[model samples]
Target: MPAYDQTRARVEDYFDRTATKTWERLTSDAPVSRIRETVRAGRDRMRDLILSRLPDDLRGARILDAGCGPGVATIALAERGATVVAADISPQLIDIAQLRLPHDLQSQVTFHTGDMLDPKLGQFDAVIAMDSLIYYTASDIGAALAALEPRVSGPIVFTVAPRTPALMAMWYAGKAFPRSDRSPVMIPHAHPKLMSAAKSAGVRRMLRPVDRITSGFYISEAMELRP
Candidate 1:
């Protein structure tokens, strides 16, 4: 297996080559109308969930989305009247996201090419990484939590795979979804120390739920960074 850093770069490259196609692939199995509704609903729910955890009003809050992928969440925040800065490592993904959004809403969302570990991002009322943080190592996750700590003025919501060694071993060793570029075969392993790092970083709210919503590959949680 490739080292985490190398694999991270490889995964980014893989997405860059296939970002436009990836969204289509992810939505292919479902009905087109249902897919749209699901995605919109999911993004709205995520926005509400994140905003509810915040102290500042979200009507015009400045929100930053790290590794925003195709920018669905970024667009959702913008639609909710937020000033969103969506950053991704892949410019191609950002392009697609930009194209998907409206011209007027375009002004509300500024897409940038950047990584989570970079120090140039400055700060925001909330920093949401969604599923992108799965690309980090234990130390990387810790560093990410710490890096966003200063920038996070209100809350930070992130998701990851399960933390159990058995699940991690299975994902790292088996393939869940056949014929998917996602390498259903190889998935990121969540670290136990992440919870500690989050708490130490002043995260007051934690939601850890292991269920089908995660597609049975891992558990999904929302860590609310308080203060």
Candidate 2:
């Protein structure tokens, strides 16, 4: 199989097996309320970063939440009155996300299970792929952006694992560490590579580190793409 396909398969498998645990980790660390509080606060910061980049009022906007895991951001967007289509490659995660929606808010969101590169996804007023680009290499990132470019009428917001010495060391260490539930592959891309991809896709882009984890070992960056 191709390297990108292999990486994608590993990511799907990893998330499929750990969907529930991952969702729990997002809201709570468990066995410690303080840790849970911290986790929630960090999640809010990331969510706010995405929201701040979007128009202040999204009541009539149509949004696509690419790689929407467990419907966290998807639900948030729907609650803000944006018509949302949430898609993920992992079926388990999509199912969990679907279950998380309230009955009244059901009409505001639709869910799909497939790769982000799938062409039938159609277009949207805006697109957000939170923390999902970490699985792709530079070339794969380019291809994914190419796929998403025409589909977005406005900005495309996504997060990537920044490429820096300290961050790269942490990524390698995570790979070296023994873990029963780890994915087979983990890739990080440099900001320049991502910008080049956006440029090739005929979009203007800007990036900034929105959050730091482990004191620089891992930084979450937010990138905005505009036509």
Candidate 3:
């Protein structure tokens, strides 16, 4: 299987069955371990950073919130006046995301369960994948971005695990988990290397690094590929 497909399969199973409730709680107001709390906080900051890159007025915009785990980002986008297609690999997570979305914003968001890059989801004005692409190899990520680039008129905003001492330590620590219990392995990349890989894979737009968010165990960098 291609690296993206392989990682997507593992990610689907992990989030759907193994870690569904764990994530539900983490994304919710429910209490969690200090470590996980940091992760949640970091994700909030990353999401905010992603939003900042877009225009302040999103009215009439069409956005794809790829790998929208529990709909937090989807709801936020809807609140900002953008019509959002929230897509994820796990049906279970998609259901949670749907249920978590406020009724008032119901008309602003649509939910899809399947590939985040599915062309059938239709073209989009912008695409935001948040932390969803972190588990793929740089080549796989490049290919994934290349596939979406043609369909998006604006930027394809995404996040990747940055090559850093803390993230490396976490990657090593994650190896201690039993194979059946662990989440997909995270692949870290530097921006320069990632840009080269994306270009080689036929991604025409420039991949520019926006910012990095680090709160305890969570370390993700945001980037955008614009036409």
Leading candidate by TM-score: 3
Off by over 4 Å in 1: 1-7, 25-57, 164-192, 197-212, 216-219
1-227: candidate 1 lDDT, tens digit per residue: 13546656766776777555755344235344554555545544554565455444367788888777777677777877888888887777777778778777988888788665566767788777766766555455655677677766766766665466555667655554454455423344444576665556554555243222232333344554455
Give the best candidate by lDDT. 3
Q: Return the lDDT, model 1, position 145.
A: 73
TM-score to native of every candidate shown: 0.72, 0.83, 0.97
Q: After TM-score superposition, what is the CA distance of residue 9 in candidate 3 from its true location, in Å?
A: 0.7
Is 2 or 3 the stronger prediction by TM-score? 3
Per-residue lDDT tens digits of candidate 3, residues 10-123? 999888778999989989999999999999999889999998888878999999999999999898899989999999999998999988999999999999999998989999
lDDT for 210 (candidate 1): 29
Better of 1 and 3 by TM-score: 3
Tell me, what's the RMSD of every candidate? Answer: 5.1, 3.2, 1.1
Query: What is the per-residue lDDT of model 2 for residues 53-78, given as tens digits with 9 covering 90 to 100?
Result: 78877998999999888888888898
Q: Assess each prediction's global lDDT (C-alpha) against the native.
A: 0.62, 0.73, 0.91
In model 3, the runs with Cα more than 4 Å from the true position are none
